[model samples]
Target: MAFVGVERAVRQILQDDADVFALVGARVNPAKAEQGPATPYVVYQMIANEHHEMFGGSAGLANALIQISGFSTSKSEVLDLREKVRLALQGQTSVVTVGADTFDVRSIHLEGDRDIDDDPRDGSDAAIYGWAMDFRVGYPEPVP
Candidate 1:
């Protein structure tokens, strides 16, 4: 069987955490959250990926740069949520199963983070506060 993608594995990892679940439940989404998503949600996307090579041949390993963003009405809440995300993923190494596929995470590192405030693009007055976190994940390539 082929291995699971890092996005699926990361979502599973966040959902499996009690602290993160208590804060955002299953609101972790890919690229973006649901339309009008409730306060305190997380959105993640794979920003970059690099496959290693040795002797001009496949090295059977990869590094993925993923960005996880948390959004909420309250700035403090968004910050708290981002912190929970950090705790759940930083320095993590584990096996995650998404459906029948397995992902063996070799290492995870918190690369950077920042506060971001967004004006509603829909012309709504709701103030949206956000925090963006970047992580670099190392893992073996998926079996073909």
Candidate 2:
């Protein structure tokens, strides 16, 4: 792709959102995000936020995507990659470059009782419930 072409393609791609997949299509669960987890090639463990009795919300779903970028075709490579991820996740990794993307949303929500950050002295204007909308984009990996 040429630079000019890439610019146009990205502009179009940015205009749309990725399609979300069913969590239990072939697995066993609901779904979250516009799409599912990244990949399931080399899962060291399950990423979930399961409660003692039941699984939590998207927290459980988000945890399902494991990071295997450091995986190596050889055992030595795997060991090295594990160490790299360990250090990287621990803020030991130095980024060579960085990039980001954003989205424009309309309506949004603020749940939980704590969202009420109002002045107690002026309780007359206190809010019982509120609602709004806003665009949201996903940045699956940022700490790296």
Candidate 3:
């Protein structure tokens, strides 16, 4: 079975970082709602995954595509948050312990980033600036 420890690890790393935490507190969410929380927040989702196959159809490694999006009232704030996320995650290869199972993260690479247009769901005066970042994370799969 494929373990979702990578997601947990990413969230943990972001939450642990002082710069990211100071901006959003603990507002990191997976597939966040269209309208929720105040500005200056983060939302992430697992976009895709590719498994590496060895001989006899055995898989030992997998690449997970993750999308992390930052939102705020100002463009600068969202861009800053996106940079903080990149600093905390890019090129990180370490053992992330989630529960009893520990998964080794091989690496994290920033695929790309884009700016989201101002579209406020709450109909407030503030213009919501968003930054979407895509990353490819490689990790070891659990062996039976």
| Predicted structure with the largest TM-score when compared to the true one | 1
TM-score rank order? 1, 3, 2
lDDT of 3: 0.84
lDDT (tens digit, per residue) of candidate 2 on 37-126: 222111122222212223432321111122122111244433433333232232211112213433222111111111112122233553
Encode model 1's per-residue lDDT on 9-122: one tens digit a residue.
999999999999999998999998877777789999999999988886888899999999988988888878888899999999999988887899999999999988776645
Give the Cα lDDT of each candidate.
0.90, 0.22, 0.84
Question: How much is 31 displaced in model 3, in angstroms?
Answer: 0.8
Tell me the tens digit of each residue's lDDT in model 3 across 1-144.
Answer: 346467887887788789999999889988884465777989898999898887767487889999999989888888889889899889988877665656688999999999886577777676888988899999877645
RMSD of 3: 2.4
Give the runs in model 2 whose Cα sits over 4 Å from its true position.
1-46, 50-70, 91-144
Better of 2 and 3 by TM-score: 3
In model 1, the worst 10-residue window by lDDT is 114-123
Model 3 TM-score, all chains together: 0.88
Candidate closer to the true structure by lDDT (higher is better), 1 or 3: 1
Q: Each model's TM-score, in the order given?
A: 0.93, 0.22, 0.88
